[model samples]
Target: MIKVGITGQAGFMGNHLFNYLGTKSNDIELISYERDFFKNEKTLEAFVSSCDVIVHIAAMNRHEDPQVIYNTNVGLVNQLIDACEKTSSSPKIIFSSSTQEDQDNLYGKSKRDGRKALEKWAIESNGEVVSFIIPNVFGPFGKPFYNSVIATFCHQVVSGEEPNIHSDGTVNLIYVNELSAAFYSEIISNKNKSTIKMIPFTSTKKVSEILNLITSFKVDYIENGVVPNVSRDSFELNLFNTFTSFIPKKHFPKKYIKHEDDRGAFVEIMRALTSGQSSYSTTVPGITRGNHYHTRKIERFAVISGKASIKWRKINTDEVFEFILDGKEPAYVDMPIWFTHNITNIGDEELITLFWINEPYDQEDSDTYFEEV
Candidate 1:
């Protein structure tokens, strides 16, 4: 197995990449990294010597003084190089640069200079370096104000705060999961050459266009409890998923309205503007139904009969969210991407659940990963 470590394992992109790599434990052994390591030479050297590959992702993105950003970023690159040289380590280094390298700003200049320094170190130490010029990245769990504009907008919309657009210029974007997969592929490729690769943007949109789309999701999904028309593999679908991730955990287990008549009672299980497949299952008491999660598909579990407890825990996290539902008061809980979830029959009678997903199951590319909640 390849031993890989990430410098900024706690940052937005770093955390996503770290967790994505965690899913491939059979092939890659992740080396733990803490921010404090950079302050200590011995610890940093130990980290450098232990890794087969190191991804340098930690950098100061914003500060009141632009020079501080430049100094901090370049200083990080220097420290990493120093640690490598001190330990006589030649581990392959994957550097994360930004598209802002061409802009007339300190952040851009820092990325440019940092990449050049790494390139110099690779040449002198006979080490491998892959410097990626990445575009704007967005995804779930991103910091509202610090990560990206998309994250800020999603948070604002979800929290009932009005979104403001400073500029309507077009933006090239890549989802965090997509970028993580690219990084993983590179780590496994084992190419023993130093090179610079441009990570292409997967989607492009005007600032206004993105805001409008997210606002529409707030109206449809958040307010009306209706899933908007979204197709699998579409950028809209990814954006919708990102928007939903910002929702407060307390908003879930949404109760459905039940209509009662002389004969019986009826309740709508789901309302969507897209096509999907619906299935139901009967689970015996004391049995659990699911311990899997989907990466792209939107799924929901509605308790139609008996009492059930649904649990969810995002990958690489200890916090687990749970909701209880009964047949008498119909309710549903939607599963978010990258979260392992399960439903248990907590009652005496058989548990009946109605399942709805945005797409039909395909064995060839199910996108399902099994994990305990």
Candidate 2:
């Protein structure tokens, strides 16, 4: 059982790391944490110092200006390195450097500097350090804003729009699952040696092929000469495959879910969310008929048609969070355990929700816990 600490635990890569850690059912103790150095360095360092393997992931991911990128990416990494140097007991540092070649762009520069910094720190501390220069990583639990080509492309396709490409560039893409596994393997499995392995891995497929495999959804393939020469099956299984046990399972009891919402209001809502458009109006209410909540159960909800507010409270906390269902939002919301939550039909006619859960309904673990209709 190895102790692990993950920084940048909230962004696309961070979320991927956390999701992977959450699914593990091993003696391994994983502590996933996120830090935006611009926000809180003290808390970030404290978190990094808490584990045996410190996975540093936070940095300025994408930008054009060299100074801007260096200041945000390289500069911040310097802070993390400094923190490690000062630590009474510095752990092995696993930095998520980019796979982009030695280019001059801000993104590339920062990643390069990060790699150097980690090497220097490891040498100074007489401790081991590993860096995985990952290529395009894409899959579930990934952020749509940055990281891989898949999220951006998937957003375009799902919104019924064409993606704009600067050039006909084919990237080496790996599923999120694969990248996560590689991370774990290098950090815990190979922590004994002070070696740097530049994995110019082979299992990379085109973005179009990846999009097809994950979902049945279709898209108009735009951008001439952009597709690569990789097979569909070639893109499966990587670091992320090991993290599948952490993912929540399907959870919708009974053979049926209520209300089909015939008018397609829910579909429009999903369109709006996916397109990154806010303030769209729903012509009808989504829930043509009911109010519901689960006891000791968790659920994930996605908007299908018109816009609506999902009001939910944590099981034993007064903290409440309201999310507006949209296509740009994640496909689902993770409901809390033993929480009282409900979706109101805020649209003009009817609203719709596409939801699922981690487990099936067991009478021993199921109930409305209330009898108010």
Candidate 3:
């Protein structure tokens, strides 16, 4: 197994990459890293020496003073190099540079210089360094303003704030999960070269176009409780998932409109603009089901009969969210990607739940990972 460590394991991209690597425990052993290690030479050296590969992702992205951003980013690369040299370690370093390297900004200059410094270190120390010139990245849990336009727009729309576009220029974007997969592939490749690779963008969109898409998501999914028309693995689906991640926990357990007549009462379980597979399950009293999560699937659980308690917890997070639903008042809770969840029958009698997923389950590639909520 390759012993790998990420320098910025707690930051947005770092967290995504770290969690993605966690899912490959059989082939890789993750080395823990903290931001504080940069402040201590001994600790940093120890971290560098213990790893077979180090993913250098920690870097300053924004600051009031552009020079501070530049200095901090370059300083971080130098520090990592110092730690490697001090410990006589020659671990392969995978540096997360950016497409900004070609732009006329201090941030871009910092990335260029950092990559150059790492390349120099690799040549001198007989080490390996693969620098990725990455495009704009977007995904769940990104900082509203600091991360990217998608993150800022998602947060603004979800928080009832209008998103204003300063520039409608086209942008090349890559989803965080996709970027993480690329990083994982690089780690597995274990190439012995100090070269740079331009990571291809998965989607391209104008700033205004993205805003329109996410705004429609708010209107359809958030307000009307209708899933947007998006196919599996489409950019729209990824953006929709990212938009949903910003929704407040209280927004869930949305009550379904009940239509009552002389014979009986009926409630619509789901309304989707796209095709999906629907299934139902009956659970005995006090029994729990679904200690699993999906990475790309859109799923919903509706309590059609009996009382049920649905719980959710984002992977690698400590906080948990829960909702209670009853048959009398039919309601549902949608599952966001990367959050482990479970449903428990809380009532005395058997509980029935209607499940809807964006796609039919394929055993060969289920995209389901089991984890406790």
Candidate 4:
């Protein structure tokens, strides 16, 4: 279990990293700093002091002015280093830097400066800061343009537009999930300290080849400086793209069955709501069909397609409620927390329910209940 604190909680890359770390693979306690890394100095200090790892993914990587880059990227790293030094314990600081060989852009220079600061900090502390330099990570969550070549292509293709390639630059791009897995491998798996891990997309294929294979888009490969020579043979990426294409749409509001309530408990517990006797038939969906209850435990009626209302009530409340079991809009309906109820399908076909409850179900933690309503 690692106590990891993330600086840019809402930033695209940082968000992906946070989600990856939050998975079941490792026991991670995460606290998101919703403010800028430097602005929230006190919060960052407290977070770094308490945690074992401080992953600095908050930096201005793209800026027109060199001075702005230096101030934001390099200066931010320096502040973080100072905070680390002042902390009670020396937390391992891992910095995420970029890679661009040909251009001496503001982003590239700032990253270089940040790396130097990290090195200086490590030396000052006698090799205490464990750092990792990552290059060109592309994934599902990130927006296409910012530091991601593959995403740019994918974004263009998905939006019914053609991809724009600058000088056919062939840079190594690792999938976000793959990069995340690699980080876990380097950090938690590798116990050796006083290490600076640099995972460059050094051996990846040309951007031109990836475009040709994945889409029917036209690409003009630009012969650039020191770009990798490897041709794109991304079987994994292609296969995923193919599968995604066939789906034609994304699934929203993912569905799952609610089984938190036991059949026996629900049946017995629901008996208390019976202020008045109600007739219910078996052969319907069963006791487990309408197992979920709203947050306030409001009364509800399970309408049997052809049968009568099965009157039921909540235990302690003893609130009176009824159900319209037969028609599309069952009459005598007093559904809320008061009436815990279930209906049967007396007519042929699936029981078409025109169900209603007095109150909307409290979406969080209210659905799974054993009590009647």
Candidate 5:
């Protein structure tokens, strides 16, 4: 079995890599080097010797001291190379570098130098290295208030704080899952390279566009039962999923505004994409609800309170079906796709019923035809 070692396994991309590799890592032995790995000298050497592949994910990117960032980043490569050499092992090294290597800043120069150093060591010692200059990566479980804008925005908005945007410049984004897949491929495919650029399948969006979409998703989905139009595009859905992951458990079961008067109250209950929607309504005595047939949407009707009679009929058939049910029974009847159906209050009390549909309501193509049963 091939052994793979990951440094900084708890960090964002590192942890994501560990998880994605689990899908097809059955033949590979996995090792992790946390923050304390460098402190213990013997363990670092032994870990390098034990692995057939090493993913170097540890680095100081966001630091107050420029000198520290430069020194730590450059020193990290030297230490990794020295440890592997001391063990007399040529384990393939996967170094996670940043795209800032092209810039003239301190962080950029240090990363560029580190890449050069890795290349030099690989040539002189006849070792294998995969140095990847990756783009901005963001996904689930990323730390908020750190380097990830998506994570921080999700956290601040969930916490009722405004997102702080210094500029509305467009930002390139690559999901952590995509990067993790790249890591797995390098480890398993045995690809040796001097410098690898992970520029595949990145999405670009303006800062304002991102924040506005996420904000609209929050207001429309959480406050109201309306599912945001995340189905319109790929990035919208990704952003919505990321935003929902940060929502605290206490935020669930949120109440919505109900339009009520002397008649009764009406409100949208819940919505989903493929699984459909759920809603409830109350009807006075002798009041009948729903006289419609849907061509495609599968529906369910349950008598939640009082006594009710649910009736249905095929569009062009003389046969009519009726089900007498009460709240005490607590049973639901699934409505067929093309059946015209309705429910009526047959008792001397308010009849409450819950409804579920297989798809959210669409005005343009409602798939609903009006008919009386």
Candidate 6:
């Protein structure tokens, strides 16, 4: 079992690392780092001893003062090394450095100095170290004004304000989950290779390109109810998911553009560009709609009437995820690729569901796989 400890458990990168580690069913435990990590020697030593691997992610990147950044970061390294030295068994360390570390700037210098300190400690203790020079990581729940420029753009767009692109420089981004995946790789591979570090990147795009993509995603996917061709760009799918997750809940299930007359009204719920079809299913009380899986087909269920309990279970897994939806609160849940799923009418009345598939359903090639939930 791997006992891992993360420095910035509440911060963006640290939170993502925490979540990713939690998902893996491998025998791994998260070592708790106390709040007064620097001040309390007993807590620091105990925590350091408990961890088999330590991930240092807590560093001040936004401070204006160079000295503050330098002092805080280097001091963090000092405390960590001191704690580790007190323990007989030294743990492998993963330092979260930055691409800016090579630049001639204060933040860069601070990160560079911090990495040097870690390198020195690793040499002295004969411990392993892998300092990842991470790029800008963007994802959901990031602070609007502080954490990421993507968050700023998404917030501005959702707030109906003009997105401000102060700089046109290209920005590299890795979804936080992707970053976590990289870290998990390091954890699973306990080989000692600390001499020289290698930098990795997941994706990169121009600032204008990313901003424009998000804006289009909001318009086409959210407003016009178009399921995007996520196959076109995988990273863009992550960006779209992050942008949509930031949209205010009150603006969800946005009112459709209605064509009205004296008799009735016609509202187009959604329209896909190349393929896909909309489906409707009505389930009475004590009845279920689906107990199946899909290999390539992507589906979404929006409960437009009554109530439902949508459930998903990964192939050959015992765990099942359940999501409740009702017409009173309009929302949609997308199905997983290989996960078997179903929707049950939990309310007293009939359950009405609207389904969207990525491709037009064919009687001959439905692409649907069934499994009992």
- For all candidates, what are the clash counts? 0, 34, 0, 12, 0, 0
Clashing pairs in 3: none
- Over all chains combined, what TM-score does candidate 1 have? 0.97
Query: Which segments of model 4 are wrong by more than 4 Å?
Result: 101-103, 189-192, 200-203, 216-235, 238-373
Tens digits of lDDT, candidate 1, 1-373:
9999999999999998998888788999999999999999999999999999999999999999999999999999999999999999999999999999999999999999999999999999999999999999998888988999999999998888998888799999999989999999889986799999999999999999999999999999989899999998888999999999999889889999999999999898899999999999999999998898877889999998999999999987899999999988989999998899999999999989999999999998888889999
Task: State candidate 2's TM-score.
Answer: 0.58
lDDT of 5 by residue, 272-295 (tens): 553567889999999998898764
lDDT of 6 by residue, 202-251 (tens): 78899999889888877886666786667523686677667765765444
Candidate 5 global TM-score: 0.69
Clashing pairs in 6: none
For model 3, the superposed segments whose C-alpha errors exceed 4 Å read none
Task: Kindly list the per-residue Cα lDDT of model 3 for residues 1-373, writing each as its tens digit.
Answer: 9999999999999999998898888999999999999999999999999999999999999999999999999999999999999899999999999989999999999999999999999999999999999999999999988999999999999999988988889999999999999999999994577889999999999999999999999999988999999898789999999999899899988999999999999888889999999999999999999998888899999998999999999998899999999998999999999999999999999899999999999998898899999
Give the CA lDDT, 0 to 100, for residue 39 in model 4: 77
**Candidate 4's C-alpha lDDT?**
0.52
Q: Which ranges in model 2 have alpha carbons more than 4 Å from their true place?
A: 36-41, 200-202, 206-216, 219-373
Sorted on lDDT, best first, the list reads 3, 1, 6, 5, 2, 4
The runs of at least 3 residues in candidate 6 whose Cα sits more than 4 Å from the true structure, single-residue gaps closed, are 253-269, 273-299, 308-346, 355-373
TM-score of each predicted structure versus truth? 0.97, 0.58, 0.98, 0.58, 0.69, 0.77
TM-score of 4: 0.58
Judged by TM-score, which candidate is best? 3
Candidate 5 local Cα displacement, residue 321, angstroms: 45
lDDT of each: 0.94, 0.54, 0.94, 0.52, 0.75, 0.77
